[model samples]
Target: MWTYQHSDFLVHQIPALENNYIYVVADKHSDNVLVIDPALAELVRDACKQLNITPSHILNTHHHWDHTDGNAQLVAWYGCEVVGNAADTKRIPHISKTIHAGESFDIGSLHIQSLDATGHTIGHIVYVIDDALFCGDTLFGAGCGRLFEGSFAQMWTTLQSLAALDEQTKIYCAHEYTLANLSFANSVDGNNPELQARIIKDTQTRNMKLPTIPSSIGLEKHTNPMLRALDDDFCSAYNPGKTPLEVFTDIRSKRNVW
Candidate 1:
């Protein structure tokens, strides 16, 4: 487990089921806590016990089993309200509150706003609270999720929306894929100094057994290949005059086989 403290919230990153991350966000001033994508009930429950903060809510980004497998158990144990996209209400177990894009919710004094990120899944959404973005599979450190439900254009639009946030915003994506993603990024953008530096830095961090998460939006803009799909150098491998969405689709196809 790794922990990060922000101005109004404390975030705990609990690794579960291979590379997946289950986040526990707690109010800094009170016992109010919100668990994000509790994939493993035991790990989340034990972490809550150690932190001395009981979860009052569970926020889901999508309907994937790995993201919602613990919902029923956690709701049964803690009676926490399960909040997810209304479009995925039937898929999210024990759902108590169905939210839509642009809606805002609260945990203590922290205000959380939801963004429609429906490329990885039809109901996939990312939550923004203060300076932190709790993005599920929509965005990764240097990669994006596979287009399992939405179109390439939809995913590109979603990425554009997230990229428009403050450059300093911390992205809390749901996987430990920085190293692998950066390797692929290096293969595509080998001439980028920032991407090379990030690869070295992330290698050291992983070697030290540290979490390489909570990457900043500024850093991703400089290194993430998916976000750089429209860059001239990045699109050089494809045909000229390709639209951003077309370039993005080509890059995604290459990554699928990479």
Candidate 2:
């Protein structure tokens, strides 16, 4: 588990069920603890138990089983409210409250904002709490999610919005896919100095069996091919003469096969 402390809340990144990470966020000012994208109940249950916390909510980024399979079990144990995208209420199990994109809400002292991220799956949404982004699979380190149920255009727009966030923002995506993503990124943008450094650094992190997640938006903007796909120079280097969206589409297509 990776723990991040803030003035008003505590975040615990719990690795479970292969690559998935379940985040347990405890608000310092209230009894409201939130579990985000829990892939299994035991890990989260154990973490909360150790922290002496009773979760007040289960927050899902999408209705995918890998992200929500433990929702029912957690809810049964804690009777916590489940929050997700309003359009996905029917899909997200045991959803109790619906939130829309651009909407802001408070969970105790933790201020939260929602962003529509529908490329990984339709109705997929990401949460922002302070500078930490629980993006599920919408965005990944060095890459982005596949267009599973959304169009390339939709996913492109979503990436644009997320890339525009504060550079200091920390990304808490759901999976451990950085190494493979870096491999693909190197194939397309191998000469990038920042990416080369990141590959070496993240390689060491993984070699030590530590998580390489919680990558900063600033680092990603400088290294991730998907985010860099927005740059004209990147487009010229890879898919010459293509527009930003065109470059993004080309990268996604190549990544799909890679």
Tell me, by TM-score, which candidate is best.
2
Each prediction's whole-model lDDT (CA): 0.90, 0.91
| Model 2 ranges with Cα > 4 A deviation | none
Residue pairs with colliding backbones in model 2 are: none
Model 1 stretches with alpha carbons more than 4 Å out = 230-239
Per-residue CA lDDT of model 2 for 31-53, tens digit only, reads 99999998999898988888888
**How far in Å is the alpha carbon of 32 misplaced in model 1?**
1.2
Q: Identify the leading candidate in terms of lDDT.
A: 2
TM-score each candidate: 0.96, 0.98
| Predicted candidate 1 versus true structure: per-residue lDDT over 1-258, tens digit per residue | 889989998899999998999999999887778999989999999999998889899999999989999998999999999999999989999999999987898767879999999899888999999999999999999999999989989999999899999999999998999998988888778889999899999999999988899999889988998988646766665457787788888777788888
User: In model 2, how large is the Cα lDDT of residue 230?
Assistant: 72
